[model samples]
Target: MTAMTPTHGGPWTEEEFLALGEDNERTELFDGDLHMTASPTPWHQHVTTELLVALRAPVRARDLRIHAAVNLRLTPARIVIPDLTITTAIDFEQRIVPGSCARLVCEVTSPSNAATDLVLKMHYYAEAGIPWYLIVEHKAMTLRLLQLQRGTYVEHLTAEPGGVLRMSEPVTAEIRPESLLPEH
Candidate 1:
């Protein structure tokens, strides 16, 4: 999706963006501008929810935290709501979590917002110093686990529908990609 025009043309600060209130569409501050979108489909939510359940045990075992669709403050003028967020126990209290606090950020790809999830978010997450990023592509039936290396995310592991996604870094989890498919 193209970038949404701001309600107020701004290089708006974080406070100004939040002050827009909840009446508007789902909005994000990207490079001090607004990025808005309609509600996501159930397919997207299904993929996201299953991944969250799969990752929870491993993350909690390591004493870290996991959350769904929360505002992540990458910078004063840059805020994003990731599909899922993982952080160290220390910064879990902050509502708009500092990007430095993030260990992993996950995005479930939507047809309407594919670029944001598959491309833009990777750049943003890496720039925010987030060490890991996960993308679950529903149409493609694949899961990718990316790790930041030399300031860019490298696809460290990937699994197709039949394969189980296994991770050893950051946390340990075995997730079957096909299990996230929407029920017909």
Candidate 2:
């Protein structure tokens, strides 16, 4: 299950896409098309790690599971790797988590994929009926919590650097945007 590149073209089947296997590149399948992005910067990885650490205890207390960089299957043709996901349970035998099981999905935006994370993924997550979406903007050093309302997302909270974001739904936790950044 290791491959350097996917050996197929557009309109790829799920089996073909999955066969691409584990690699350094960030690969996603959207409506039969393959989209690939560069590996995340070290800063991006650090932020995701810090957020995971901040969320683990509270999420675990609620008997939920939190995972980083896991495949989330929204539909037969659309599968994405979210930066972070909180779920009620994971089917260890399955290769992807169904969108229906997701409680919250988080994406930390890097310069290269800001638009996809902020706009495309947000819309897709909402359409799949995921309750919550969190976006962390790299350049702005801001965190935005969005709640799904009537098939669209509404901003519930926004925290800038030096500020704190506290939320009770999905999981009860306080996140400081600045704390996600690497120390100088």
Candidate 3:
């Protein structure tokens, strides 16, 4: 995907983009600019599904909600559709509504979006005051967890095959590396 700057055909507003509504097309709003993403690959879906399952244990009984690849509105000028998100909102139907609540926002690193996820997305989510942000990568088959502090994300922990990711405070969970990789 090509990086862009503000132009006549640039800087899409929330209303104009939302008006496009939910469609097969996957788009993201970065600095109020629109960027299109290609369809997810099998590896992406594999990681997404595994994350949903792993997070379920932590959320199901605690009444927290975790979602995958869902549209999320961060501000009037910005919106982020994360690969995974965890929220404490009680009313699922009401909270999942576009432009609503989010506590933890996660993104799996992909070739096209890695830089956005690692740098830009982290900045956006943290600036929005999201409590937790996770970045899972396939590099050498490892998963890295990042937590927000003082409006920025810092490395919280890392886990690889045969190891489990551990969290502290607001939430606690473990992510086995094998669980994230696509099955042969």
Candidate 4:
């Protein structure tokens, strides 16, 4: 695990907080602060599963690693469980180990998580130095890609159902939004 030295008033230590994730169902620790996730709706799981299938192929072929709903240690005490994430196998093992290293993070927006995904979680991922972030919206049937530059999201590529998501890092890949989404 990558060690982090907590600042004067930082959240709980990684060990102290992550230890709670095993039994807790709704709550997750983000940088030591607790964040409670609402029960996921069926739509959320459907999209998540579809996206996972789309991603799993490229990752498996290249032997790269990815995870689902896994806690990522953004810092010494700050941890966030992103819905889906991709990272290098080595970095994944060394920096995050049994948790996550999350070079690319994705979240399916739920009514309860839209603001957090667009605002709070966006800042947290940027601050933690994740290279890319993807937000998929259920209502609009859209996919948004954000690439980090200079500690902020500098590039954005958005597409609706028939649009293609072209990406070539962490693993070269393309995704047809419709194939990875449920019919409305």
Instruction: Tell me, by lDDT, which candidate is best.
Output: 2
User: Any runs in candidate 4 off by more than 4 Å, and if so which?
Assistant: 1-11, 90-100
lDDT of 2 by residue, 1-184 (tens): 2124456655977888888788788788888888788778899999999999999998998899999988899987899999999999889788788888999999999887788899899888998999999999999989999999999999999999989999898999999998988999
Between candidates 2 and 4, the one scoring higher on TM-score is 2
Those runs of model 1 whose alpha carbons end farther than 4 Å from true positions after fitting are 1-6, 90-94
lDDT per prediction? 0.84, 0.89, 0.74, 0.73
Error of 1 at 117 (Å): 1.5
Q: In model 4, which range of ten residues has the least summed lDDT?
A: 1-10
- Please list the Cα RMSD from the true structure of every candidate, rounded to 1 decimal place: 1.9, 2.8, 2.9, 5.8
| TM-score against native, each model | 0.92, 0.94, 0.86, 0.81
Give residue 84's lDDT in candidate 4 (0 to 100): 90
Please, what are the lDDT tens digits per residue for candidate 4 over residues 1-184?
A: 1223324365666776645535324445565666666557777888888888888988877777778777677766667777898766644333243333567899898876688788988898898888889888878878888999999986567778778878776666788778876678
Candidates 1 and 4: which is better by lDDT?
1
lDDT digits (tens) for residues 1-184 of candidate 3: 5434325475788777777666665777766778777667788888888888988888766677888877777786777789888876645553223444677787888887689888888888887888777778756567777777887788888887889888653467877878778768
lDDT of 1 by residue, 28-140 (tens): 88898888887677777778888889889999998888988778898887899999998886555555777777899989888888888888878888988899998888678
Candidate 4 TM-score, C-alpha based? 0.81
Q: Cα deviation in Å at residue 122, candidate 1?
A: 1.1
Q: Which stretches of candidate 2 lie over 4 Å from their true place?
A: 1-10
Score candidate 3 by lDDT. 0.74
- In TM-score terms, candidate 1 sits at 0.92
- Report the lDDT of model 4 for residue 45: 81
